[model samples]
Target: MARRGKTAAKSNPSRSDCSSTSNSLSRRPSSGDVKTDLLQALSAIAAQHVNAGSIPLAAALQADLKDVLRRWKQEHASDLQKNDKYVYPLEGRYDAGESSIENVARSSRDPRIDISLEVGNLSGADEAVVRALQSICNELGFAIFLASVERARKTLDEEVLDEAVRLVRVFLLDGGRVAEHVVLSPSEILGLQHLLPRKLIIYEWAAAISALEGQGQEEVPAELSAWIELQLLELFGQVPKLYVEDGPALATVLTPRRLKDIVSVMEKFAGTTPALISFLLAIHSKEMPISEETRQAAFKAVFATMLASFDITQDPKDVRMKANEQPYRPRSLDPPPKPPRIPCLDSDSLVQLTMHVIEDDTLRHELSLFTSQLGAQTTRINPLDFESLFLPFLHSLALKTTITEPHHEDLRTLFATTITAYHDRFVGPTPPIPPSEPDVADGSRRWVRPPVRCTCAANCAPLNAFLADARRHRIEFAVGRQRRAHLHQMLDATPRTECTHRTLRGGSPEALVVTKIDWDAVHKRNVRAAWEGRLKSFGGWMEKLVGAGVDLRAVLGLEEYERVVERREEEAPEEGAKDGRAVAAAAGELRKRKASEALVRSSRLQNAEGAGRDVRRRVAETVAVVDLTDD
Candidate 1:
């Protein structure tokens, strides 16, 4: 009842005969046969759509995409195995930066650096905070590269590490968290780069602790630790930049203020903890010879105190930390090789320890900042005054046994570039209740700072007055002025004409000669001394120049006065010899020049004054009279 189809079983097969086939069977199509006819019709329709830049896909076709690929994979699995390559990559979402074929057939199976990282758990985070920390770490990386390593090395010693950790913890507890990435403040960072090492060390420590305590060990970031450290110092040249050779994280979270706080905390331990102190001492490549017993006792004391801090248990939510891990306590297990004369401390010797703080390069740097702020007025607090100002502070610091309190020497020494005998003492208010007296419940006689008085007044009068004057201008000027005043006294009161010059003297004008009997014989013998009659003034030498006018400055050597005269001369030049304007100008110039000459003469007398002040300055001015009589 069925008819044969035209589809050939073999090439060039003939068509089926329609005459022998039943009419009903031929007209009605079977399901399998109808599918072929349907497919051919759909293919033609699809071709039309394709030409029109449209694609039609059935639900089954779309859903079966993976399955279709699976089939293809199965068919090509042997070829794929032989080639050791991806025949093609599945495509939908990918960068087309490099000419994009659907797939990158080449296989680069080597390790990769993942710059793109998944930003998880930052949903609730303030983006600003994260960005800030990231930025800081990057900046600091350059400036503090060496310092970080040095700090880490110091931490290798358990005693130092414990102390250092404790300090960081305290700062964090008190006022430690930084808002975001930032550079160190100018006040701290401008003076010395020393803070870098300490900052770097703490950052590395924090980072290390985080890795251990769970900041994350998920994947090493695009930034390799070593590379980041190197970049921190080397790249950016005095600035900080992050080098992420391999990492998955977006940040290296350290900040300027945070680093400063951490450094301060560490510095606290630097004073008390043997570990920190010794490590610092060692950095100087010097030695402090201490007996075994003394060192042992001191270190043991530190250790015991540390243990007490450690005994307190942690919260249930926190991990069980190691003994030296706490930030509050510092431990010391080793004692000195030799025992000291006493057990633990000698107060006098301890007092001298304050000097080290004052001498510390880092502390000095901080102090330098104060001077910078004080500006030109820095001299107001001279070495002596500065030392005096900070004396009480230093004394108090000297009394402290712990590093918690700030050191006076470090702070005060900033102003004192050089201390001498002048600064050996400083005066302040004395308390009404001495240490020997009992405490006053009513607070009678409160102590107040007395006004600073001039020390020169204690012994010398002129020096005292000079000091008062010195408070206005430069001290050197004041001293010079006093010297000049003294010179005037020596020269003016001690008349030159009455005294013998012993050196260049030919003056007896103040003495009046009673008689001269040898005048007759002398005149007759010298009658021909002047054969030709000559006329001469009794005592006259031309004050004016041979041709032009005399220069006031050239004669007096008073530069300022010369300038004044020169300015006048230029502003009002002489016109004619008889002109009234010229006459007035000449007279004015003469008066000014005469005044300048007097000042010059007084100044020249400075050496004769010596240490005499009143004798030189109290005298009246000298007058020179020229004789106009003819002989």
Candidate 2:
């Protein structure tokens, strides 16, 4: 019986052995099934931690999840060999209608996984939470970041706003994965505009947009471009206010290209004229980087606006008077007056703006256009406004060293027109010429006194007549002490005259004697010297602006130039003056140098003539000798 049982066992195993074999077969799992099970457990654990506000723990598990996914991908590489499908976790479900197990089985070939979490109240969240959020975002994708931004936008909390800005910046700096995932549409950006804090807009939002545009990842839609334009306009509108609030901070925000972009937008959009002018004016003297093209556009816009707003008939003096008059004050307090329709820039501001316009080489053509237009209206411009605005502008342009040669003709025309319109200011009424000195009978020197007229009621008519006579140099007013004191006061105030108090021999009322010296010549020489100095200084500037080819005297009008510039050459030396002596010495030295130069030239000419004559004679003699040899 035992041998028969052994044979049977060998032929077919017992029930226990069959059960063990079946159990082993049932318990053994395939590699695909093992990967599915591991992913399911990880998803469940991550969900549990997220729900329980254990984000740090969930974030920590991301590494293990990634590892399992990687190994699964490596083992069953063919299974995950489909198009990129994001494994979005929904209650541990992969997608709608698919079980987690089925999705995990499919995910063997899908390497991309994105997790969307709803952790409430991130406003006061700890740094660890933020860090974990960042980690999840980096591992997963931009969907996570978009979800956070939406949450923060809804909350509108300051802390939430900051966190959202920080997250978006970090994501964008990571090469703008969001833009890659989607087109980064304008609607999406515009929707988030309000959520972004103004203080952080330049640093975060603008920087991100700049980066995206710079990368040229995708074509920017028209709507998106328009949206960018509108946002830039709004930001430029706030530039003045921003500068007033925090100038240095605002200065640091803009780069040259960024500023150029803003100005270009302003140029494209109409009715942004005021904002453009204000923005340029506000950033005028700052160290902010601005391109020449931008400055030209801004200045052109400003000039166009100013020309449009100009009223030739409206006198600026009258406007100023009206402005100075106090507004009607009702018994009740009134609202503030509306700002001027045109920007009322002060003289200094206008000067700075003009300088910026003139110094930019690119604006040469535009400047010519503006100056031509300005010159046409020069006569009609209110004198007060011309002096306050245009005159200073011209002065700044004149002084600017960067002005190139191309602008010279326009500047000359503008100056010529201005000089004609405002002749008195440029060339005043002719100054009075000093009278000649009188002939002295005793061979004593004398000078004619300037005429003096007083409205005092006294018998000083004699003294006045004597002072008015050019041939007489001495005058005496003999009167009471009070009258003599009055005469002394008048003579003391008068220029180029000396006064002496003399008591008559018999105590006759004290006499006030006045003698005019040759100080008038000295005074005239000093005035001429100062005028010459100014002319030389102005001539140097003209040389820079108009170049050497264009005659400055013609541009200035010959009469005015000769009076202001050339008159110094014709000045005569005053007698008994050190300045006169110096001038005479200089003239003598100049004449001597000229004479020596002429003598040297004459000597060189004579020596050349003599050598020519000698050469001719030698040649004739050689010809004669050749003829004799032939004979």
Per-residue lDDT for 1-631 in model 2, tens only?
0000000000000000000111111222324543353334334443444455443344334444444434444444455442121221112211212324443454465434222211221222222233333443344332233222211221111111111222211112111224212222222231334333344333233333433333233466675556655665566555322111122222233444455554443444333322334445644534434455654554465456544443333432222222344556667577777744322334455455556666777777766765665677666655445555555555566565332255467777877676455433432333333334533334333444554446465845666666656666666667788887777666667666543435454457766666655565557655655444433434343333343233434566545543433332223443434476787787888678766865874686567633223333332332343232221
Output the number of the lDDT-best candidate. Answer: 2
Instruction: Write one digit per residue (lDDT tens) for candidate 1, span 8-83.
Output: 0000001100001111221222233222322222232233333433323233322222232233234345554321
Candidate 2, which ten residues in sequence have the lowest lDDT sum? 1-10
Question: Pairing residues by index, what is the TM-score of model 1?
Answer: 0.15
For candidate 1, give the lDDT. Answer: 0.25
Task: List clashing residue pairs in candidate 2.
Answer: 80-109
Stretches of candidate 1 off by over 4 Å are 1-159, 162-229, 234-282, 285-421, 424-631
Full-model lDDT for every candidate? 0.25, 0.41
Name the TM-score of candidate 2.
0.29
Clashes of each: 32, 1
